[model samples]
Target: MAISYSGYLNLPHGFRSHDILAFHDRDSEQTAERVNYSKNLLEKGILWQGMPACLILQFKKKQQVAITLLAEGGKDVSELEILPIVQRMLGLNQDIDDFEKAHYRHPQLGTLVKKQAGLRVPLSSTPFEALAWAITGQQISLAAAISIRRKLIKALGITHSCGLYCHPNAEVITQLGQDKLHQVGYSKTKAKTLFNLSRGVIENTLPLDDWLTQQTPVEEISKKLIEVPGIGPWTISYGLLRGYSWLNGSLHGDAGVRRGLQKLLGLESKVTAEEAEKWLAPFTPWRALVAAHLWMSL
Candidate 1:
């Protein structure tokens, strides 16, 4: 079905055109293409056009916002719960101030280029997709991860009318088997991990969506995530941050984040996992944003 989605998110001060570009780049290249294809501009919010959908968005000083979605026929806007879906997808539900404080300025790295009070935190609606992607990304270059993901998605992801690919659900992955994933270039261990994660999601062993609304502490969530085979601390933390949008969470072991911090602090080598936690202490609620910025810096 063809559906267009768009919305304005209140951004924080120091937020710039480049920052938005950088954020899109960090998240997904396909999304970046969608954003650019829409011909979006900083002054004009975000503007996009394509087969699946097209849209325009405008944000004012990270406060007031507006959005327009254009879809060709299959589903009516009102019937599809568009607003809530867009809000979640754009991460409008998060508090930018909280995020900013959680990812405070580093004593050694200096100030961030943008310091807005309400920057948006983008997330995937499909937690399974996020978790699976996080697993695929472990210990690999971002470019390599994307290549594998593209191959896997092409082989298994759901496709819409305009050729837009939606991530497959856990059930689909579980049914696909480890051998299929291996064919997509996943290491044997990685394939096993993906299958195990898929099994957890399918059988309710890992209650992903429930955790989002549950009162469980981040530590508890982290522990549960780690209980799954192939999901280590870094993978769990990454899932919490991106899939669940858990504020204050940091992926200390992420190579990209570590490298970014090293460059930001002028270190000779990547910060130790322990040191990374210490270094990120000041940016409590917004550690995710700090990670976002670090990704951009690199």
Candidate 2:
């Protein structure tokens, strides 16, 4: 079922239609497909067995959230539990200022990045899913990772509509043995690691939600995430930044990030990850935003 709602939000300075659309695209990739863009609007286009279902998101006056849902003919949008989903999808209840100050800025790096093309920081609902996806993507070109993920989701993940699947939950992964995972293109070791991580989530050996909400600090969250099998520091940091919305974590080890930084700095030799951190210090809280800009710039 599909439904839509629209409203306004009061946002911080530097908030633009593009910014909100970028956020929506990042946050909704697992649930939606082909978010079409224009000057002031984001149109989420969904295809169920090649039929069209659309959701249009528009922002007015910075602080408002506007939603519109389009379903197939005769489908009852009124019966769907849509408002809450829209709210969550828009992150309407979350504080945008902190996220803005920490991640979005208008400084040197920010300016360069904003001037670049097609850069975006994508987000996921669950840290576990983000972590797993990051692992699956490691050392592989993005296209390869995406193809593998599509197959993986088709094999083990559940879909709300045809060809639209949510990231598999811990329980789902726990039920899919390593052999099954290997069939989805995971190396045997990677499959085992994924299974172990899923077990951790299902058995509550790892308090995923608590850890995300814990007052222990971002560094601690990164550390704890890294302790999980198949999750490295890069994956953990990206999860915290993109999944939990931690503003200060810079994805230094990412090759894309490195390439972006090199282009930004005009360096002859690639900057080491440590050096990249120092270079990114100026962006501070908005490092992730800067990172997004950098990615877009490239």
Candidate 3:
């Protein structure tokens, strides 16, 4: 039997529900997240606190949203547990007022912010998910990364009762050997890194979930993550931005970010990573948010 719980959540100011819902539009396969545009709904499969389930979010009138949790085999989840996960995934508490006020009048970012206001850094369902995605995206183009991610999900993701695949958890990934991962589109080095990460999680050495619970400083967490092989600054920055909402992770190494900066500055030549980092230095403490704005500008 299936079980469900329903509740209404108040939308935060600057919550661009439509834009957030549209995030899954480009997914070549429905592995985890799905959106029903005409119904203003998004369905995502998640493994929360050892329970695999599906969450359905319905955008409604009056700036409030309704959420339903569907769990197979009658597993139950309380409102307290469900609400926080929903809040985090939706980025409800990620306030950008200070960022907007500080940069609303800047020479370059100001216009982008005005045009793309309320853009919060949306997170993966869990820190592990973010880490895996970052590893998958290393040194790859966006289209290629997405294709590889789809393959990984299809190969290892858990299938929910609704037929939607939940992104593979660390334990699940560990079940596959490097050969299998390679066949699923992961490069040999990336496959090795994935094993290291999964083993770290299983051995409790990484303690990602603990860091989130304790609200550990981003620097502290980054230091630990950087020690892992194949985990570089770009991966750490992107993962921290998406997983922990650490807004200052310099994304200057990202091709899209650099391209966005080039376009924003009206530069005729491609911007070097060093140059991009220097240019983005002024937007300290919210560099990731600024990067998001730049991406939206593209």
lDDT for predicted candidate 3 compared with the true structure = 0.84
Off by over 4 Å in 1: 1-33, 41-80, 98-106, 113-119, 213-216
Q: Single out the weakest 10-residue window by summed lDDT for candidate 2.
A: 44-53
lDDT string for model 2 (1-298, tens) is 5543333445434444464465545533444444446546655544322234555666666555566656544354441345543443444444444544443354446456335422334455456766677777777887677767767776854544334454576677788888998998988877877888778877877666667555457776666667766777677666666556665677777777888889877899987889878877776666665666667667
lDDT scores of the candidates, listed in order: 0.63, 0.61, 0.84
TM-score: model 1 vs. ground truth: 0.75
TM-score of each model, paired residue for residue: 0.75, 0.70, 0.96
Runs with alpha carbons beyond 4 Å of true place in candidate 3: none
- Cα lDDT tens digits for candidate 1, 138-176: 899888988887788678745444445545667778889
